[model samples]
Target chain A: MGELVVDELEVQKYQEQEVEENGLPLVLLYGPLSLLNVFGSESLLNNFRLIKPWESPEIPLHEYLITHAKNVKALVCLGKTELDSKAIHCLPSLEIVVTCAAGLNHIDLIECRRRGIMVCNAGNAYTIDGADYAVGLLLDVLRRVTSGDRYVRSRMWPLKGEYRLGSKLRGKRVGIVGLGSIGSEVVKRLVPFGCKISYNSRKKKPGVPYPYYSSVYDLAVNNDVLVLLCSLSEETFHCIDKDVLTALGKDGVIINIGRGPLVDEEQLVRFLVNGDIAGAGLDVFEDEPAVPRELMELDNVVLSPHKAVFTPESFIELQELIVGNLQAFFSKKPLLSLYKNALSASS
Target chain B: MGELVVDELEVQKYQEQEVEENGLPLVLLYGPLSLLNVFGSESLLNNFRLIKPWESPEIPLHEYLITHAKNVKALVCLGKTELDSKAIHCLPSLEIVVTCAAGLNHIDLIECRRRGIMVCNAGNAYTIDGADYAVGLLLDVLRRVTSGDRYVRSRMWPLKGEYRLGSKLRGKRVGIVGLGSIGSEVVKRLVPFGCKISYNSRKKKPGVPYPYYSSVYDLAVNNDVLVLLCSLSEETFHCIDKDVLTALGKDGVIINIGRGPLVDEEQLVRFLVNGDIAGAGLDVFEDEPAVPRELMELDNVVLSPHKAVFTPESFIELQELIVGNLQAFFSKKPLLSLYKNALSASS
Candidate 1:
């Protein structure tokens, strides 16, 4: 007994079983219904015990979370999942939350701060793709790419006549809302298209050459196109209201790749319908999966399911970052994409 | 007799009437069926006795041109109308042809040269808009902007869950077919999007830094995207055929803002239908508005009705150039935007 000399095969089998069941850390895979299956989450499964509460159809996510996922030390949240105080309280032992998204509006920073839990985001993974989508939306709306597609699809060109001419993108006065990583990239991309780039952020981005407007209204008043790339905060909520829309005027277009709530969707729809604004290219909605019905037939408004950061490249980058950040967290090494503002606030 | 006459009001009335009827140098508006009404041609009407054969509808264009337009000294052509030898023969006094388009494929350069007919095109008016459209199509195809619009329009997003993730536009290797003004602008636009640009012009463009592949096949082999910006000619007609498409491979996309026959339409349809290549964004087709029926159901292809260079800004610029060039020709001044290649070859 002291030397443990007997039945090494049985001992090895027992140890292997133990390691298989409990050796790796657990992570709550929180996202859309199809999240765990799609998005190449198998790599995460290889290293962590991934428990998706929504996978079990019989029980609801919150109940399942409280019952079975209490001990999970980490949560891997995807885009737009509400990770508030009540949800955080369900997982009592949760030490870190890693979001596979650029936006963190769903995460409760105050609650997470009070509990002293760490947070990680997708970092620069979304920056390039987000910027690309923003510009793509702007181009699509300006050139009527989507409308032209619809007209062609309906066989309208031959039957009726040529599709109406769209306004040019070159030399457009573009105002970027939020000169963050993604917004900066948007400015860069639009620059070579001959667009005059300016921006509105919470504060002046030091050393940036693009003209900066202090308020969203001032930005809207000056620009022919307002690209909404700012995050949704209390101050930023419904920031693109009727005042901003009116300021943007009849010829101006709005491109929203940020959170839906960042825009006043109802007002936007009314503006778009009444021709108060020229058009909109929206990737996110006020209530996702519930786009305004009026937008269905609009040639000007190009609606997209929130897919700005959902490119294959971004997903791969985010997956790697999630793994890297989690590994770093477990090793007590510096987390790759730690939300340092939140961490520093709590500290 | 008029100098000796004392009736000044009657003389002025006769003079105004004569000017209205035939005094202004006649210009045959050679274009599509509805071209006279669209495209801000009212300004053109003010400058010259603009005669439209298609507008009358009493006789066929050929017959109308023979009877009514034989005395016309200048012709203003719109896009894609066949101004070949046969059409040119009808207008015996056709000293010059001004096409309100970037492409001059329908103008029959060889025939025009043989007949001593000068031709002018839209000049740099199409350059900015053409580049904008090429990049727009590339972005739309890569980001599935048109497809996303369709999906949302079809109400498939909520029903079908999430739209599939597209590949990133960042870091794509792009091959531009022609390195003219528009193609050069396309390079400038795609640079900040992180695309690696190369080209296959007739010869290597001087002082350019991008890699130049002399052959289309080689260009297709190395690039993720092939943008057809070359004018359609004997050499470039059906240039993107089976070999070129195959070389482009399954992941490569084609954005054709050039003339229709620049690509072999039948082979492209087959490649797209069979998934031999990724996708295409086609503004022009082999036949004037008769898009392949097969492409109607495909999400991979985005079809446009040759409106790439038809933005409002371009129209105003083109209208001015059209009038300016005609005035210059009449005044024995150097023609603006003259197709010097065709002129030089003829001389």
Candidate 2:
């Protein structure tokens, strides 16, 4: 019996050494899609042994999570993953959750708070790229850049004369719906173009020199362009509806870089079709990966997939931030990018 | 005999009263396209009686010019019109020529100079719009804004996975080929986006903050993106050739908002096809209205129909400037937007 016990202990020690050759912490990455290692960050792989459960499509997700539950102290969630109470219960040893995206809509923040599971996100990592994209979409719509590209590609310029003139951006009143990181960056870019900036947010930020509006309708009424960059929550869902579109009027243009549900997309299509509103530059949709068919033919509207934050520079920054957060969490140091004041619960 | 003389005097007085009813100058407008009266600028009509040769297509152009030669003191030249030596000779009484376009390439400046005819262009009217369009094209190319728009419009998002990531604009080293009005405006707008700007112009602009490169090769080697916003002349034609493209390397992008001949179109097409360069955003082509069919299929290139300066606000401003120049000419004041030191002949 003593000889058998000694043999078992030696076998266990060898297995531990094989699994953690570099002595890095073991982190279980659970998500429907496996994107944690796609960037191939050397520092991340050198620091932690990321166990991606979704890599083996044959294995059931629950079984995989249970297999690593005892040793896994951290979970890395991708954008599409949902961390409900059941998933949280399965990860009994999980002390922290790290998301590689800015939005936390997929994560059950309430459950995380209840369980005291610290969460870190890619905070301000996507802000500049997202803001730059919003401006690009707006310029594409107002100046017909995409439509012009199509016309040239279709071999129509030779047949047609000069293209029809587009609207100008200088001196136009631009009302930003959100004054967060992305929206504030948008304001900074537009200022140099001579665009008049205004805003309407959850609460008036003190000392912001831009004119503040109490409501979206009021903001639309006075501005030539309305740019949506606010967060997605219950109170903000469909915040840009038919009434706001009607108030925006025929000469008004709207740009939505935020989540799609923030605007009543169906009404927006109707307004665009009827020529009630001048134009729109949309980067997000109500049902993403599925935009309205009516928008495809409209020359006045510019459509883009939800790729406002997908840039190589931004991805590099995000990878660095993610690596930093994980290292900090394991060391019991302050989380690098913990989104404080979780207001969506109240919203 | 006395009664006959008195009857002739009454006839002359009636003709004088009819001509002076508006008290406006008689300005001869010669072009295949009639665009002067289209804007319906009452101020222009109140200031001068514009004689449009293209209005009566049935009449010969020479006959029309000869008919109005004696009374015409000013001439308005549109884009398609060729005011060569012969045309200038026909209008012996022409004192001033007004073109509502930024480029005066269509006009025979040598002939005008020989005749001592003052020429006024659209000047800074198109500066703001042109700069905005250049920035828009750069953004579209670097961020894949137009391609993403097409991806959504083609209904490829649902079928395909996430679109490929794009290069970010932040921290990019941009090289402006010409630091004139439009290029300067582009530098101003790009500053807020964290782009480091440099330039290569006719001469190093005194007191300009941007670093100046004496040669295009040096500029291409150092910068990540090269923008062509210089005037197209003999010296500048095909300036961005194979050598410059090679130096720009595989990761560089080129934006041409200037005349198309500024860059070698064939070399550009080859470079783009072979991936020698990352991408290109071209608004003007070597031949207007006739873009290379090869460029149509390339996903990295953004094409426009030479519409960089085409905007309603800019057109409105151009109309006002044209009127102001004509008024200033008639009143014998300094020309508002004259092209001093016309150097295309030497170029």
Candidate 3:
């Protein structure tokens, strides 16, 4: 193995030789895309044989998974890959799944729980970065940061006289839709900006100083800006619908750093067009990489391509956490970001 | 005055009759534009006779000022109008100059002090708004909020795939220049975002927890982001010069919400062009209504047309302060936003 040379020839040869070469346990890289290329996945290469099925586009993913299932004891998934029951069934020897993202909606927790497979996510590693992004989006929308940039870039300021004034962020009533890690972080950040913060979570939190509304509609009714940072669950899906948007009213804005399905895109577009809602700063869409064309043209709204949780700093942190979880799982000590609630349920 | 009916007819009539009609003390409204329309300047109209030179464009400004200079006890000046020594000479009877802005650099404080003419600026009225804007601009630049918005708007996201990753705001070293009200406000705002904040003010602030650098160059050298929120003066003009920008390095961003001359705009443009500095968010420029055309093409820079202090909420606060200052001057009370150092120096 001569220090495991990562040459192109060796990389190609390893694809044909799918066994646990050089006494390294196999860790299947499930998807074609991963941020592992960032640090070159050096940490993983040192400890395990990584079989990336998606690297060979000619091979069917299921066929590739089955071929290496006997030796594959772990799997690492990226953003877009689906790890459902069928895929889980393919990797029968897999004992742990590491998702390199804050959200685990793409992973089937029920299937993992039934099979006693521990799942670890990039946990609080992204909390501060995600919260920072949400605040940035809110400020951009309310202060017209992006639109002002466009106006300046278009050589329109000298021609257009003055750009329109945007609403102030300070002292605006802000309702955070969820009070989880990211949402809590948003509250902490907004407090110093002088925003009147309130929130709506699934259940009342005991010690939170913020006034809690029982429902999202009530939260919207009372606040000027509704920040959607809640997880997308069966019960939380499409949480920000026409009714919530209507309650938010004409001068209100929505900032969605949560899943796209949390907001009803059709209703949101209609509201923005008719001036029923003032503006929105959206980082996600129902179908990613495909934003509504209507949103693109609107000067009031700011659009980002689902990049809320990504930053070089956060990516570096995530890579560390992912490696830590993998090492912990292989050593059987404990997974660092293990979804412990599901683990407890199955135990 | 027939109950001082504020009709369209009377508004036109007031332009023709610029004297202290109905025994109201005259307040000369300098320049053509004012945000007076926002709240209708009811506060001013209720207390004083308003004289606007630019209202009747046919009447030359010099001619108009000469006509009403005797009774122009207070002059309300907006952005474009230069209330220089000549303007002070024009308004011979001027007792107080109420500038509708936070910065008093526009007014000749020296001349005003020598002449026993008290000056009142927007004061802390713009403190929070300016700070909010500074934060918005910093976030926009660092997180690529404005550029991301541009990418989405230009219909390039689908073609370009993922936009370039932006530097994270959290845990980065941020240095604020000028620890005045706006600067202090920025410090307060940035603290919660997990930044290690430092500042370079004229002197060390009493009991400030953050480390203090005595010079702008040192502050720039030590920080990842430099926020310009200080007053522009002879001592501080072009404070952020080529050396400061270079010390800030390739990943550092500069956010300017203070007066434009506070930073060397030409050097800033050069640094941004060459990627010597990562980015900048500028709200003010050395020349008003004239930005470097070179800057219009850069994605790394976000330009705002001196709009940091223009929100309706802030404007309303400013109007109240202006009216209060005028009334205070007439009543021989302390001016609301008096440039007190000059007052104390001259008293």
Candidate 4:
């Protein structure tokens, strides 16, 4: 009674039997478990046993899944991990796959549906954070805040001549592409700067206070600063190309917080070099973790490592939301689901 | 009209003669005049002869007085330039000396009186511009906007773990060391951030909405951010010492836009290194044009050259105001002067 102990193997066997009888779910955490600093909460962790890939470094994905497949129910993963049919076949008991990110192109929705699995993504998770970053980038680039800092850091005091002259953001015109969650949030923060806000979306958002442009080129032409906040789809791919950049004119600044593929990188470099655009602030890149040296050479651009939603506060919030979604799904309650049409019809 | 070919020097001489005979008595231009892009504006030019050092770089002070002294009633200058008995004696025709800056430290008021010359300094020229730069510096420092920019430019993508976490200015307590012209302006700008404002001045102004702290130490203790907007003089020099910095505590961030000499540089460096103070945004340093390399090594500080009021708009406004003050002095009308106390007593 004072120090009661149970056989470890017997306890493990009993737990496995209970899981097999109740259809226990498997959740594979593929990326850094330091994300636990983000997603770890007593209520959130109680729902599932997290399988961290880092802890089991040598274990191959197929072998691990096959070994643990009997009672597996779901897989929670990140961008770096690929989920395909061959890998999916190993997890015979897998039912649901959740991606804690907005983009779905990485996940094979058709293949998931064929395997009778539900796919859900975390959409608008980066909306506010991304928007804030875009605004921050805009301010940093236009004001030459970073260049001034670098100058001082290099022990080059008395930054004389044109270096001292930084552009003021007050009363400047800001054009946003795609008035989605992130785009609208960008407008909210920028309103304080007294910028005249205009935007180009697929269609106008009615009852919204800001002016809307019918065409992306028209928005670029009229705005002093053009912000890329649109979604990256077939129609919107490379929408902000040479012609759109030309429309932005010589003194105009362009900020891209959307996907890298949304912009024509070659054309952007050309425009920035030739003074077709005054400057740019980019968070997303084409083939990221591999930023172009050409962009680095230009002092006019402010680049971020696509870290719009990587704040500590945002990470915590994202984790809480993901946990809430999982809990609701398990409890047979309506989940805070994204891409409902795609999920219901196919995946 | 085609036959009337005039000599450039002759035309300049005639123009100078006309100005000496009928134009304004004083022209106090504190800032650089090249900022006024529209040089051909005859109306603006006809208002007053420029007292800018850049325009007449080769002309000695003695030569300037000798050439224009015959009909010149007064002269104009800035606080950076010294106005001693020698300057007064050389400009024998100068009845008044107007300074196009807030401080009168450079102008020898006692000597001006002995020489029977009137002195006036522009007290409000720096108010709004100083406030703008202070807020800009605060935002720049707190958000690590400049550091982020540098990271991006260096082609370094900040992965989740590598990202530098920046603090938000909202809801933070800010202590203003002096509630004077620039300090009051700083308060007005900081109001929108929803920050709690407290201040310490030699004496409190009537109807100051913010809470007043009697002592700098007390203010530093209570506030998360401390902004030095006090005037640099004997009593206030090196006011923010080791003791005050210690009082400011570990979480406090200091922003000094007022003066370099106001902060004890060595003590500040020590505090910064030991994390006694979180960070600083310095627009002025103890030895300007020679900022310490040690300060440059730290990422927690943002340094700018002494350029708080160096905007093109502010420069233009200051020039126009100075010219107006000069015009008033030459007409023998009661000057819209800064030193009315001394002037009335002298008269």
Candidate 5:
């Protein structure tokens, strides 16, 4: 019996040696399919064992972590994934956490710090792309491009009545709620349209071309169109509420490409129905994928999925940046580190 | 009978005297509802007798002209209303033919010249608006912006399996087939995208920034995208045929804001299906309102009813230009014309 036990112990030691020799450190990837396609190609993922738990609908979070947790050294997560203190505690070997996207509200940064786990995110990767898309949506909605196309395709030649008339962007006052990278890019695009740009951020930046306003109500009142580009945080939740919408006045358009929580959805629907606000172009929603039926019925609103940065160029850039971060972390470098500063500064 | 005729003539003279005192000439208008809105408003027609043949699908050219022809000094017409030599010949007192939109192919220019009839069109009125829409279509088609919106709205969240990736317009080679008013306007807007502009007009204007190509095939072969901005005359009909599509290569996109007959519909359909051409954004069609059913299924193509310049700014500008033309024609002043020079130069 003693000899048999010795043999079993020898076999266990051999298996451990094999795993150490050939197995790679863990990387948990979450997000959409594009996230995987962008970063998990064999050539890019050769240095790590990339595990994507969200790829299948049936894979429960606890089951996934329990099965793969012992070997996980790093995790790459998305906005929807639940990565709280409890989830972090399950992964005994997790040394770092990286996000494939810019937003970090999903991950508990304080918990990660408490556990001495490093965290990094892809910031400014989608700024220009998102800004470009927001402007595109604004123009699409105001100009009624999609509706016009539908009218024409229906064999209605030379649209008349209200359908024939569409507002132009030229010379309209555009209010941007945030003057960060995306908002600044939007300003750049709108400049050529000859629009007057007004912005309301937490504080004013020097030497910017647009006029800055401290109060959201003042910004909404003066501007013909309001663009929400601020980040979603505790302070900014429901920042553009009923009072701000009311201050926007009649014949005002509100475009939200930021977070859905930035604007009160119920108030937005009410304002739209009551004709207090002229129209809206929304790319993000409160519940997402389950957009309100009320918004869908309105002809005035233009809706897009939360896909502002899904352009090929932006996607490629995001992939490269995420991969670079991973490689840097493995090399014991700073990991393009931008957590505490961005949080504090943005907050 | 002679006394009755004399009395009728006296009554007609009395009406003419009253009309002249009112200081408005008779204005005959035709075409779609939007055109009527722009050119045939109540205020515009208040001074003049506005004659519309809505009851009769076809304008009764001779009878209508004979009845109201004598005092109808200015005639406002649009495309799809036949204004042939017979019609022009009958309107003996007609001094001007002012079209509310661009494209004068339907007008009998030779007859107008022989009869010394002054002709003016709403030149450059729709240029900026049309160019803006074309660019919008290009960006929208390439980015799959509308498709993305549709997918999300239809409850297809977290889309999987090879989504259509969009290319950026920045730094792409854009070939303008004709550098006329609309083409030039398109170039101005496209400049900000950092696209390299090339052109192939009948004759190259001096000091233009873009390189000129003498042959359409050459332009198609070299360009990443070819935009048809030339007119559709007999000489330029089917100019961008199968050979041109072949030369454009498989990856090139074609945008035609010009005439649809400039492209061979059969060849275009074939190319679009077989992936000989990447995609197309068409505002005009071979037959308006009867778009090819097959083209509708292709995700690559974007179709708009022939409304490239249906903006409020252009609408107001068109009205003002038409009104100015009427004012100038009544004063017997030289018409602010383009065709006399363009035709001669092309010949």
Candidate 6:
């Protein structure tokens, strides 16, 4: 159940071996196993015959999809490739779209809805890891854990004598940018540390005990730390702007585990460099692999290379969620992780 | 109340201005303010006329205490100075000893008992910070937060591609040594992360839910991570030696927020270098400020400059505990942080 390839080689192997004997319906895999080559631990590779099409030297991706994947009822979308209208139109027989990610920014949900393609995502798979990484990054930045490690490794402790003291995490007001599942998990974890949590979401959540601010700037004004866990949309992109950073004040720290575009990278760098803000712990950047040179030089900021949710455990969970949702769709039973909004639109 | 100099200069100023004005009682302070120059935030420095002594070219510390500090009724012991029999003997008129630390290893408890002197320490002041740091170190070590920070800072993400995945911290069996206030707090913090907790203390604690192992070796064999938080005593010196390290196996992690020498530094260094243990997050070392040359080269270990409990909030709490206990003693009231065993012996 763990074979991973949205490419020619695995497809060739699967088609040759079990297509006729198993009589399993074919589903198209979207992309190759990208990061760490981890496609899915939960993929029942033998249960389904897999085929993929790419913009190739011989034939274009649209032609390949129409000719090779025409009868493919399920299309799996990995985060790498954009599943836009062009790609969706090529898969005319596609009934369900399964994505192994919590965020659906990569796939055009509206297009999928117009085609009546039921969409499901990895539900709660990365929530704990995302929350854990956010809290870990915040604690690391506040306590200077990474900086202290570097200082010790540089043999500065013997030369510099006493290191600087870290501020206490307890009693610090932490404002969460998104009060979704990841944000809620972060709140649960921070509760034990005695931190005061407030959140900013699209709307004021009913049952949430903490105060909610409709605007991100107001949330920044009252909190010592701002944790970004919300999705990246046109409206939400650069949500943490110069004004919000200013409102957060000089004692403010930012922990970004969500998409990098959630914070205005240029203004954030300016604030960080000029000491407008205290520090930051960023796992994501505006550009995926490219980080600002100024941030690289600063000791106050901790730079993580977008591997916050690369835990083997979470990947396993994602594999299960993806495979289970696909099976549920085929069985005509209730899909496990069907996008709630997608259901409302379909109805 | 916030003046921190423990040298002759503060003594002279206090003796002239405060001793006569308010008729404040005198107490001898130990050591200069070390590590972030944070002496105490809660210290009612004006509440008592402070005096201090040290062996210098001018006079020996014992001679300075006996001659210049004979009438002093109270002595304050900072962590830097060892309060052995010789130093304790120098304070002849001392009725009470107040220390701004949780550990009593630096002080001679037997001597304090023989002299009928009351000893109190900074109670629960550093507890939250210590626990927070221990958990922080654990999360950092397991998740490779500091190393990832280093990777991104070194500008290796583009060149090297995606960074290696860190093992999940959840579901890892963690064993704590010295399951007192700090260890208990650590357990509380780890609960939400879904980690399994176990411990090795001097004796099994009653009403505690976690499984207890009497020996460190047994604990190491049963757990994936071993956290050292026990007090360093003759019996516990080098408790986590080669055998324990071997038992912990190749994938084991160690988090030390307690005193150094709890784990054999030489053996630990060898194990770390040889890959006998997975990783370590060390805040304390066998020698203060002097880390091993070998440890400096490893990315698996996170080295802190022994400032885990140096947060200003805790420092303030330490100050308050020290002053509160002293005030309680002079007024014939209960000391805030009296050593429990001392009280037991006294009764």
A134-195, model 3: which lDDT tens digit per residue?
Answer: 99999888888888877777778878677888988888999999899999999999999989
lDDT of 6 by residue, A113-139 (tens): 887888888788888888888889988
* Candidate 2 local lDDT, A147-182, one digit each (tens): 999988988888866677788999989999989999
Query: What is the C-alpha local distance difference test score of each model?
Result: 0.83, 0.82, 0.82, 0.69, 0.72, 0.83
Which predicted model would earn the best DockQ? 6
User: DockQ-based ranking, best first?
Assistant: 6, 3, 1, 2, 5, 4
Stretches of candidate 5 exceeding 4 Å from the true structure: A1-26, A30-35, A38-40, A51-73, A78-80, A90-96, A112-118, A152-163, A332-347, B1-19, B30-35, B40-43, B46-59, B78-80, B158-165, B332-347
Q: Model 6: which residue pairs collide?
A: A1-A43, B42-B319, B42-B320
iRMSD of prediction 3: 4.6
| lDDT tens per residue, model 4, A1-347 | 01113234433433322143334344665555454544443443456655545445588867766765545676676543567778778777777777777666666667777776777677666675676567767876776656666667766565442345556666789999999887877787677556899999999999888889999889988899988888677888898889998988888998888889888988998999888889988878887866778888777887776666555556666777677666666676766754553456632
Candidate with more favorable, higher TM-score: 1 or 6 = 6
Weakest 10 consecutive residues, lDDT, candidate 2 chain A? A1-10
lDDT of 4 by residue, B13-107 (tens): 43444254343333433334443341122333566654443446588756665565544556666436666666566566667776665766567
Off-target runs (Cα >4 Å) in candidate 6 are A1-11, A15-21, A33-36, A41-44, A54-60, B1-11, B15-22, B33-36, B41-44, B54-57, B343-347
Judged by DockQ cut-offs, the docking class of candidate 6 is: medium
DockQ for the candidate 1 complex?
0.46
Worst 10 residues of 4 chain B by lDDT: B35-44
lDDT of 6 by residue, B212-247 (tens): 999999999999999999988898999989999999
Candidate 5: which pairs clash?
Answer: none
Determine which window of 10 residues in candidate 4 chain A has minimal summed lDDT. A1-10
DockQ values, each candidate: 0.46, 0.45, 0.56, 0.26, 0.31, 0.57
lDDT of 4 at A131: 67
Q: Which model, 1 or 2, shows the larger TM-score?
A: 2
